[model samples]
Target chain A: MSDNQKKLIEMIVGMQSPEAIELTKVMLEEGADPNTILDICRKAMDSVGQKFEAGEYFVPELILAGDMLERISELVKPLLKEGGGGQKKTHGKVLIGTVAGDLHDIGKNIVTFMLDVNGFEVKDIGIDVPVATFIKEIQDFQPAVVGLSGFLTLAYDAMKETVEAIKTAGLRDNMKIMIGGGQVDQVICDYTGADGFGLNAMHAVKFCKEWFGVKE
Target chain B: MNTATQPTSNNELYAERVQRLNDAIALRQPDRVPIIMNSLFWHTRHAGLSFRDAMYDYDGLSAATRKALDELQPDAYVLPHPIMALGPTMDIMGYRQLKWPGHDGVSNDVPFQYLDKEYMKADEYADYIFDPTGFMLHKYLPRIATAFEPLAKLPNFPSLYYTRIIHSTRSFANPDLVNAFQTLQKAGEEMGRMLGKTVQFIDDMAALGYPLAESATALSPYDLFADYFRGSKGIMLDMFMRKDLLLEAMDKAAKLIPLQAIPAAKHSRSKGVFIPLHWPGDGLMSPDQFKTFYWPPLRKVVMTLIENGLTPIMFWEGGCTSRLEHIMDIPPGKCVYFFERTDIFKAKEVLGKLVCLRGNVPGTVMSAGNPDDIKAYCKKLIEVAGKGGGFIMDGGSGIPDESKDENVQAMFDATREYGGYA
Candidate 1:
């Protein structure tokens, strides 16, 4: 990475949004490749994840890093697409949402950020989404993995119904289905008929990478 | 007021109920484990009233609650009043987070759903630390409450130093501003009257034979911010990026928040202060995060309540299986943990005779499961959690009205059949 690129990584990981934006503008102005910028930011997220595991970082830091990276992505998307790379959906594709009757989006939002930073093309369907929406999104996105999220147990039935609908709709055979959120366990995963479960955002990332055969 | 399972007098039933609960909390085998019916909102529906009716009519609410309690006859009651069921207030306030009874977006049949939103932004931590009351009035309130949107444009509270008279008089020069202030003035009077009624209802319930389970509830510093100020996603990010600020904010809240409830607690005949813990567990955080962000201040709050001659009953909404080892380090018998999901047998092994233990039954099962299932679940729970003493079997969050009426009766039946000291 160039010095400016390295500094950009530092600012993003450190959660300095104003400086990170300025540095991105400066780099693009000097003809720096947008792909390299995204690559460095991804590495910064990986570091943030590591620190989170080691207890040096926490939820706030993860969120701020996600926010800064998102801001930076907004800044460079036009330039990258003009250079024939912005529309690129690389790494992996995953579609996630909170099940019906469940309006909680915190778990879904965190997973969306984790996957996005790791280069996964994530489509968050938001909260209280009906089962039909999941089937429709799977057809449109054709993602490799499907994640069902809900915070309360009332969504247990919704998760099960959605997973069942996906199967009946013939979308289950092609995708690796996953269930997540606060109340899920091995039993709930089976109850929802999901292929696997994620207890936290980090676990969700690992699950996606392993399923798609992507390495760190 | 005379009923079965009593000595044919209201006074005797009251004394026996208090004595039964006190015995269980002390780890002594009571006549049986006392049951606390936490089905507050359910009574409104069971009474054939729209959830909105309970919101506005205190007399109807009190009568409905009393009738339900008489039928079930649980040893204690939790928030069995209209305060929490009041959805009309949310409608008037234009709270974006709540979908309430009789509201345009939601049906009147179902209980209200409170969706979490990020009311406090990332940068407002400094403002909160500096001047909490002023910041909340002008800065935070306007954001969360849509009806209070005009308050954002009002002058800073301290800046309006014209005189004492101006403080009471809200004189908005512009006609639109005048309209806004009038709306607020009327809402304030109505909300105050509603709150007064709920408080009075609590006192009335105490005057009756039923012992109030919890008169006042406050969150730990972490949850107060997580649930109210920042949503779950917001607080987690704050933990990593603004570690110092998060810790400082928790400490400030821990010191200040409990003081607000002291006067109420001192005057009431409640068992003690109650805490409805929301965050800090269920794999949302790491063990290190639990130690650093959650445990200490919570322990301090428990100790503070105890020092004031008030006990702390912490209802772990989502269980704390992993943190039990650390939680065990607190002075035993000084704490009461009403858990929702930790395995009872495992908790018995870990917290043996330390803190009193209560609950693991999810309200979901009772709402749908057959009476036999309720009996079997309680039988197993009593075998494990009720070995020597210190166990109170309760539904996870609450017993819903949709909960099978037989299964609701079967809870106490199972307790009487299987739960015994000797």
Candidate 2:
């Protein structure tokens, strides 16, 4: 790897504020491709996540790192698209949101960030997202995965409703459904007829990878 | 004189044995599995006493607890009550006077009373600088005094008056807030005397569950402020627009908790505090929001409690196991996380050695299923979580008001029958 590439990786992994953005700029200035910078940053975040899973780091550190990585990614967005890489093929597209009536998005955001870092084209619908929005996003994005997040006990009903709606739309067979949150359990997922249930952010990524047969 | 197994008349023996349970918890071991009873309300109901009656009637409580020990033979006892009395802000402001339908203890609805239609529409309520006393008297007190009359009579009536007058007089002057909080600290110290007596009495009564010490409950400053102080939408908007104000409020609220918790820890048999996780659940905030707003205060609260010689036993409502690995950041062994729907096996693998793991039995199973089913579930949980010494077996969540007696009996029976270090 080039010195700038290595430095970009370190900035993303270390989650160093200002430094991450500055380093990304420096890498771009040094003739590094924006796509290469994005790839390296993604790898760095994945590395940070692995450390998090291995108990080497905690959530604050992971979030800090994720934030820094995002900062660097935002800087490179315009440059990457100019190189015909912005609309490049992704691992798979995902339509993700927290279910209706439940505004919680922490787990969903973590999952989205991880997915983005891992190369999945994610259309994040945000929290308190209506079921129709998920349907519309799926139709528009034609994503392989539709992930639902609900952090409330009451939102389980909405998740079930979303799944039923997807089935009613005759799109169930075309996409995989996954649900997660504090109130979500295997029982709820089974009852809701979701394809899988992710117990946490890391597990969600693992679930998506397996569901799509991604080689990561 | 070797009456270790024999029932003793003196309550002091019970206290001594209970102290040992605390020591064991500190070391992460007990003579047997320590069963922290599901809920104090249920315990009181099982003893055929009102929640209010149980709070003040020490001898009656002692007798009822003795019967429970004789029957259940648990490894420890977890009491139900916030160790410290109300803080000046909560007490004096009449926030403590708020009530809910089902429970006898103070409810978590104090902040909601301050929510006027105007407050919600203000768009800047988040940045609306908190004039503690002004917010209380003009906004919260009338609601408390009128809507929650029953709560006003419970205790700490003086603090409510102080809270009203101070807030009404000055927008943010809280000179007495610290002193009011100190009063709770004083009360906690006095509680140690009662706790010592209760422990001795219970230890002498039977060879039951270990008598463990724990706070009544704990709350993250984020939850305390957002759910109780600023309401959800207001807090969220504030985070975006008035980040500085929100941080200041959080910092002020955070400062009070540790100071109050220290005395409570001193009185606790286990030197532990049970911080109940309320928000950051499925419907409350997104995982990103949790990382931004919830985790910081939670981390701060957990760190503060740990730093102050108190262990935080977090009772996480909803399924928090998804984020369990992240929670492992707080100093290990300084906290024991109790969960509602978290993956028990995963928790064991991830946080087992680092912090004590309590709970996993489905509350529904205990409430609706038969004894055999309860036994089967408990046996499985024990098989998975009981392999290590740091695990405390409990229902997946708390035992709700509707839990069946036979099912509860089966849970205890299964533990006694199948749970041992053989």
Question: Each candidate's fnat, in order?
Answer: 0.24, 0.04
Q: Estimate, for each residue in A149-202, the C-alpha lDDT of model 2 and write its tens digit.
A: 976444666788999999998889968888887555565677678988876677
DockQ of 1: 0.27
lDDT of 1 by residue, B350-390 (tens): 98688777776656566546789789998888888887778
**Candidate 1, position B372, lDDT:** 90
TM-score of chain A of each: 0.87, 0.87
Best by DockQ: 1
What is the TM-score of candidate 1? 0.83
Note the DockQ of each predicted structure: 0.27, 0.05
Per-residue CA lDDT of model 2 for B47-166, tens digit only, reads 886544555456656666666556665555565433211232233233433332122343221101122122222333333245443444445444443323222122332345756755
lDDT of 2 at A136: 85
